[model samples]
Target: MLRRSPHHRWTLVSRVMVGVLSLLALGGIVVAFAAFAYGRSAARQAFDPLLVGAAQDIAESISIGDEGPVIDLPVSAFGLLSLAPEDRIFYAIHGPDGALLTGYDGIPAALDTVQPRFRDWTLQDDAARFVTVSRLFSERAYAGRIYVTVGQTTRARRAMALDLTRRALFVTTFGGIALIVSALIIIRSAMRPLEVLTRDLAQRDPYDLTPMQADGPQEVRVLVGALNRFMGRLDRQVGAMKNLISDTAHQLRTPVAAIRAQAELALEDDAPRRLPRLERLVWRTRSLGRLLDQMLSRALVIHRIDNAAPTAIDLRDIALTVLDSRDHELLAPGKDVQLRIGEDAVVVLADEISLTEAVRNMLVNALRHGATPVVIGVSPTPTGSAIWVQDSGDGPPDAVRATLGQRFERSAASKGNSAGLGLSIVRAVAQAFGGEMTMATVQGGFRVSLTLPHHGAGQSQ
Candidate 1:
């Protein structure tokens, strides 16, 4: 069963858009608050000075007459207040004895301060702002200070503040929209390269395992490079599979035909001649079985090398494993097969199973093709760690040595029984693990070794 992803997947574009919109919404709220405060302050600065000027003009119009203090209620002062034509005006004068001398009778009294003062109050049942001023007279009837209070309704002041706020909100709304549009455009443009890459991969042939073009931004190029490397490994695995199928079909045909032919001849022959023919038929069947087993083993080694991760392994362990299996005693019963390894470890990084198979094949090849007293050992050399099988005889000739590791290239001694796949399996394992298979004429024998790079400590070949 296929597993579903736990998270709700979102496209890259959707994620970027959501992030941009969230930021802009928060910024818009803060900007709206700032604009409202600025509007209120601007209205106050523009109109407060005018209110003070009108109050001062009204103070200059006060005088002492025969009836005590009086006020002319200057037209110039009224004209100055007319700047807000939609607002109502109120004014009042007080005698030195605090009696209402002229103008509106119900105006709120000013505070007892000498400096001009402004205050808020209710006038004619509506909210209003007022300014108060004082003057002193030395006339006979009125020799004390006089006060003049002027006020106006707040309808026009509120309208002005609201107007300024509205204009600011208009500009901010359009600017936020423009920013959102630009962010979307930029995000789509950035994602174009990935879209193109997806399209190319979707349309390519199924069998095509070619490397992709690494283009666009640095991040996109990195993704393409990783994909290319993965495809390269897959291609090698496919090639190996194809080779196995082709080799199986080509190698099995002649041996099967010969075996069938021998069996038919045995069935027709007399009892006296039948024994030899039956023996030959049995020999052919055994040779075919060995060939099939080696072919399958080689295929398995290739598969594991691609899929298995490598680890540090002691070469001595591989040598011991082969010696302990004692399959050699079956092939060459009573033949001398010596295990020669030192106490020190000879370690290399490799797949343990693949290395063991390769070493086992080396021992088998040596036992089959060389003289008696075959010796298997793990030793440290100047170049690398070596697992070797040696026999007390001269190695193959120079011409045969050149072609030794190729599959099905049998030497003359085996005649026709040998499958000639052992050395090829050793070569495959060696090359797969970044190692090499070497054959040399040693002092007392022929030697075949699979030498691999040292993992932790250096060992020479």
Candidate 2:
């Protein structure tokens, strides 16, 4: 069974909107609670003064009479308490001995000597607010202090507080919703640039690698730049592939045609002369095979140069491996491929496969064009490491040597047998490693060197 990939993706807008709305909802709840508390406190402030006023009026109305003290509660005291029409009012007056002189006896008097105080209590089994006040009176008949207590049911005050709290909650809730909606709209507007960028990319041709216009917010610009860089790399890869295909087709055409023509000639020849023609055909076929192999090798080297990661490579080890290979023994029988090196390990940073291919090609070139006693040497230079192939024969002329590394360009000496890609492959490998290929005539022979950057001792093994 084919397993499906997980589908868990979230959009930036949705995440932002969810986060913003959550914060707004939390803020709205906090604001609603604050409004309720402020409203309740304001309701208490508005009603406390009325209760105090009524208590003071009652205290002032008390007078001295023939019985020692008398109480004549004023109508204004009840009028003041009637401000909250839906509430029941209660009052009490106490003499010096703590005995209720007049009014409701159930209402409690002040305990301490406090002049005025407010409290919440249960009266007639209903929640009520009350204020207590003490007043001093001096008269010829009687001189003492009287206490007044006034209270009322909290129904009307609670109603007012609830109305205020409800209004505040409604306003806060509406404003919070508006803020959320506005935030969403702003988020969408801000994302338009990204949308346009996506649409532009979707509408373009598949092969197009043109850079996009990086105009937007800094974040969007960075994204566009990254996309453009990726496209640029893809374009280079595609171009390399195209060039390789084109070169392969063009170079192989002549040799393949030549092989077919030679085969036809061998077929037409009579029995006695057919052997020589068949031999020529075989040689032509082998040359064509060699050409194809070299072309493919060059292509592989180019591909690796573009894609492969570099590692620590010892040039002496690579030279020994290449010399010991079957192909090397076939090319130069009798152990003619010699190795010469310094004492210390000659190490460089390179891709081993490509570097080996390059060295193999150089050795093949020296064997094909120069005399026997071919030598492969590795040594450490001041800046890097060098791997060279030398042979005992006159090298190409100065003019031809200058153009030796160019693709499909061969010296007059090796034109018929060479595909002219060997030196080019070596050059490419050297350049890939930030190195260079050098040719010089030494004694009576020629030497070609591939020098690469040395890996320092501090680098990881």
Candidate 3:
């Protein structure tokens, strides 16, 4: 199976979505980080009130002990922590002597003695986190600094952080998917009018060089209008050209008819002396008429196709038809004519009648000017179709080859009336189809290549 490229599949939509998604992902990352931070702050803020209450209770419960030089805590001290779930509470009291005094004696020291009372400190214990506060009794009765510290475990804070993190991820993952789906829907909807234009265009045939219908957004409407005007102009130009060719043909017919009558009247001379001259005139007149008819017909086709669209032309079938029509011309024994037809379908946007005439003109030129075996081959190149006409003549003189573009003004009134427009017609047709024509000096004769635009006609042929 062959794979269709992304360029051929979803190029426009993918490009649009990539841009939207890049910005959306950036915003999602920023929001996720902010949510993580906010959740952490919430977990921290949730514990602050408990810490303040613990401090106040420890502050109020202190009193002189039964013994001298001491203080005590209320039995309700541990009960302060029971209000908050999963709270790990630790408390300690220290006298001015720096000795372990009351509360959990194993509880570590919490403050610098020189610091003011009511100051709080934080420390990380082995299995718990603690917040400690120190106070001083500066009344005249007792001048000593004592410390009261309160602590709680960090498990609750950590658990709350994990929960917030999950919420952030959950919101972002589902939200991002929703955003993508919504973006697709919006993009397709916004471009829906363009699709209508596409269908309108797809319904048109190659030979139908009609005005494009206008039904789209502002920009597309403008484009369609311009194309329609161009098509209208093209159709008018083609109509004018066909009329011109018909008129030219009609005008030529009158002159050729008059010339034939004059030649026949000249043959009325009973003397044999006038017979050869009269016969030559009649033959030359007939040839001139034939040439004129060919030229006018080719000119009309060229001019029309230049302005209008060309229908699909099967070059392979046309070549075969031409070759079959001229098989005896090419294979007549002793002429040494060669015909090499490659086995591939070469289709192009062209006129079948015009293309056949073009090929016939080439063969006629070869036969008229050169000896056989005239080599005619049809093949393809990198960019287009190429038809070759190589005759076994000495080719044109170097001067004539170099001066091909020069108008043959001096030869217009010649006896044979060869205006050298056969190759020119081929060139014109090629140019109308965005192809090229080239002539190269070959060994025995000349090689003329009538290159036509390839529509990938033989890729799967």
Candidate 4:
């Protein structure tokens, strides 16, 4: 035997149909109750007046006879009751002394008041309605009251009520069906947008990550906009991955070949000549290692820029953290490196790791290419926050400055000694955080600054 699934999934149309049908059923039940009540009230009102009129006619026909009272039943009274031919009727007359004068004797005489009254009763083992009226008499022979009672079986009233209910139910059933059909059409029309979106997504090329047109009802438009944003993020991540692979292959090949050749030469050289070849081999290996490390760092920085949530960071803290790492001392031993930051906090909204990597690259570039007495500092600019690395020498010549941030673009002064990715990393971080990198000749030295938009203290992005 096949097992049933634990979870049941319903389509939008199915849910809407179920909802519409449920509402209609509930409404039908309420309408049925109301129609039944209205029918009963109307039936009673229609027949009660006839019973009263017949009782009054019988009471008026009574007169004082020679002995006491005589009842002369009116033919018109019977004619009025004949309107409901399917019903059984009964009547009775009584003298002032409580004697049955004429007609059926079982209907009791009224003892409450001298007024006409109506009630429900059973006669001849069948349900019935009754009306009693008292007639006053003043004559020479008899001077008292005569009572008239009239009743009828309720068969016709019940039939009339049932007929009315049936007619109302007939109208309601057809009307409810029509309303359900119209609701289905409206629901299907409303769901068309989702159908179109599903088809568009299904037919799209896997590589196509462009934003979709967001045109529909407000809810559908919101869904489309969210889908577009998700695709955009995915596209950026894929592009970053592609760039990492290509940069790794293109930048590492020449150095890797050079390292292999130097290694082979060192192994073949005589002991007298082996020390210099070994030194060159070690230097080439270190340069290749540094190049690989910087390439990976650039890739990671790009990834984090898109994926990392930003927090409010004080620029002074970043500068202090870089100084505390002691990496600069290793990069350039015996070089003058100092920090110039005030006590006040200068904050920006950025990824901490990515920002630190950018700042570290700035210091590395200053140590490798610029003169001694290097300084790193943080300060508040009029428009934003600034973290800069300045050295005692004039910055790269104007011709080299234009191509400075491009990957692997070396200057003539470096003479093939630098990897050329430091400024590129700084530029990427600056642009990613809605900021800019500037190279300027300050009063003391050449300065490379990464200026970021100011974030309010304690605020996060």
Candidate 5:
């Protein structure tokens, strides 16, 4: 059964827009609330002073006459209260003894003090605001105090507050929407570089491993750098694999053709002559197998050189291990492979498997081309460590020796049976470890040495 992968919910731009819009919306709501409160307070401040002026005018109309306190409500007082025409106006006058002298008896005086007071109350079924003013009448007939009260329904004040709040709401709504839209546009513009980068990567060829340009914001540049490094590693690995396939096909062609020819000859011969032909066929098959083995060995050495991390390896131990392996006996039968080690430890930085394969190839090559009694030795050089294979025969000519480590280039002494990949593998291993391979004629015999840099001598440590 197949299962589907989960899809991504949001992209970077969407996330940024959502976050910014959310904050703006929250801020807009807070601003709206503050506007409502400020509008209500400003409405009260503006209208309350008008209500006080009306009450004072009504107080000034009271007089201490012979009968008692005479009150005549002024038309100017009513005119002032009528400024807010939508509101209902009411007024009342009271004697010092709390009796209603004139005007409406329904209206209540809030305080008995001599100072004016303003308050809010319910009149009939409507909300109302009122102001009360008290005055002293000190005449012969009347020597006491009088109270006057004025009130108006709150329709005008509520209308003004509503208008202010509507204006604020309109402005904030449009401004917040404009800001959110502007933010989205800016976000899209900022992400243009990433979009271009994505398009470039998607359109690239599968084998392309070129590094991308690190041009963008700092965070994006970091991502591009990592991608470039990864592509570099992939390029090297792919190149190694391609070389492996090409070399295998090229080197196996000759041996495979020889095997096929010998097989045909064996099949055409009679029983008495077939045996010799079959023997040759078997030998050719074994040679083909050896060629394949060397080709694979060389490919593995190159792969390890490119990919494997190096560790401190003692060259003396590698030499001894190569000498003790069964390959030595199989390649040089009835001959003991000698190993010589110096007094000091000879350590170099290298991959152990690659180094061992290189040494083994050198041993096999010496036994195949030179005489018996091959000596594998390790010693500390002035710069690093040296391991060499010395045998009892003169080496190839100087011309062949100069090109010894090249792939599939064998000496005149090496017949067609030789794969010619042995020294090439050795040289690759030496170069991987910051070393070099040298060929020399010494003691009337051939010597091939791999000189490696010391582990603790440089940055390789």
Candidate 6:
């Protein structure tokens, strides 16, 4: 079974989506980090201001209140700490005499630094619950020095940290979800043009070699141009096939009619009395057979060229066979056809069957159309190998030499008698084998050479 043909396509939306989502995800992460940083800074700002005020209040009242060397505070002083959620708040103030002045009397005084104004530290309660804070107040707040320490339960701080984390996570997830959805939609829309091109190709008839009209992006335009080139080649091949059919049909009519007429004439017993007509009919049949064979060979050549047939064979053997096959036309004729070698045996990698056929065809043309002592030379060159056939008499007419490798081309004088595919076949064979056939004017006549790939193996003759 044959594999299905692909109409390749591409899309802009996929590229766009990839870029957009990548950038947005990155931006969202940065924003989340920035927000968390700001919140942490703001919490420190709020905590420090409140703690400093409480310390100042205790410092100012340290001179005396109801009792000696006491700092007085309202009944709602502890409620200031209770403003935060489900937290244990503790405060301590000690006079310069080293006696507790306010807040918890049983709580030991924390080791407070004199210089560090506000920092973070941890302390354990009687319940072994730890509270963390770092704060200090100087003697500038009152007449006597007072040590005041303030901290809240860690459970509340833990809850606040959890809340901030949840908010950051929510923003990241929401941003990611939004970006993903937007990316999918944009990608689809951008690629829709390619999908349209695909549908256009899918609806086409397989045999239709019509050019595409869809105008996509620039790279897509290049792809369309390539498709157009393929379509052009296909169109030319179809046209060639049509021309072949027409030519074959026209050529067949005469021979088929002549054979029918011959059979009809022979039906009468008096046919031998009409020997002239029978002889003419036999000659016509022979010419028709030769023409048909040439026509078939031409078709095969065209087919092989269009499909790129492999052509690797030994050229040395093909050269020998060609000389052997047409010995009578070459050596036995008054004209001599000879191969002069710079080397005895030059082997080549080529299509041997086609090469031999080309040689035989060239020699046949030389004998019938040119003079004696035609040289058929085989030699290897630095680049490739070559076969040169130079006839003694005047070479092919100017028109034949001019269109040497063209199909159905011939010299005007030889048009009626020659099939005109010999040189064409040679060229086609060369092309199929990834080589070239060329004609050049030599010292006395013209030379036809088929240059093919050399295998670099030979001996000096």
Best by lDDT: 4
How do the residues 279-338 of candidate 4 rate in per-residue lDDT, one tens digit apiece? 888888888887887888888898898899989899899999999999988889999999
Residue-level lDDT tens digits of model 2 in 1-461: 97654433567788888799889888878887888788888988898888999989888887788877778888998897787888999888788778887778778667455579888888889999888898776888777788899999999888988888899889888888888889989999999998888899999999999898999999999999999988876776787688678987897788788878878888898899889888888888888888888888987887787688898888888898788785767865664667887667778899999999999999999988988788999876676789999998889899999999988888888858888899999999998789999999998579999998878772222
Per-residue CA lDDT of candidate 1, range 1-461, in tens?
A: 97767445878898888889888888878877777788767866776677778877888977767875566777898786798999998888776677887778888757364787788888778989888888877866658777788888888788887787788778887998998899899889999999999999999999999999999999999999999988977887897788788888899999999999999999999999999999999999989998988888888888888889999999888888989999998988888999999988788989989888888888888888889899998888777888999999898898899899898889988777678888898999899888899999989999999998888763433
| Model 4 bad stretches (over 4 Å) | 1-9, 48-82, 90-158, 342-344, 413-417, 456-461
Which is the leading candidate under TM-score? 4
Would you give me the overall lDDT of model 5?
A: 0.84
Cα miss at 133, model 6 (Å)? 12
Q: Return the candidate ranking by TM-score, descending.
A: 4, 1, 2, 5, 6, 3
lDDT of 6 by residue, 190-236 (tens): 66767877888899998889899748777667877888877876786
In order of appearance, the predictions have TM-scores of 0.71, 0.68, 0.46, 0.80, 0.58, 0.56
Instruction: Give lDDT tens digits, candidate 5, residues 309-353.
Output: 888888888987886677877766797577788767778889999
- Model 3, residue 327: distance off in Å is 49
Question: lDDT, candidate 5, residue 294?
Answer: 88
Q: Report RMSD (Å) for each prediction in the order shown.
A: 6.2, 6.0, 14.6, 4.4, 7.5, 8.5
Pairs that clash in candidate 4: none
- Backbone steric clashes in candidate 6, count: 3
What is the Å distance of residue 357 in model 2 from its true position?
2.9
lDDT score at residue 188, model 4, on the 0-100 scale: 92
Against the reference, the lDDT scores of all candidates come to 0.85, 0.85, 0.67, 0.88, 0.84, 0.65
Task: List clashing residue pairs in candidate 1.
Answer: 381-460, 381-461, 382-460, 382-461, 383-460, 383-461, 384-460, 384-461
**Number of colliding residue pairs in model 3:** 2
Return whichever of 2 and 3 wins on TM-score.
2
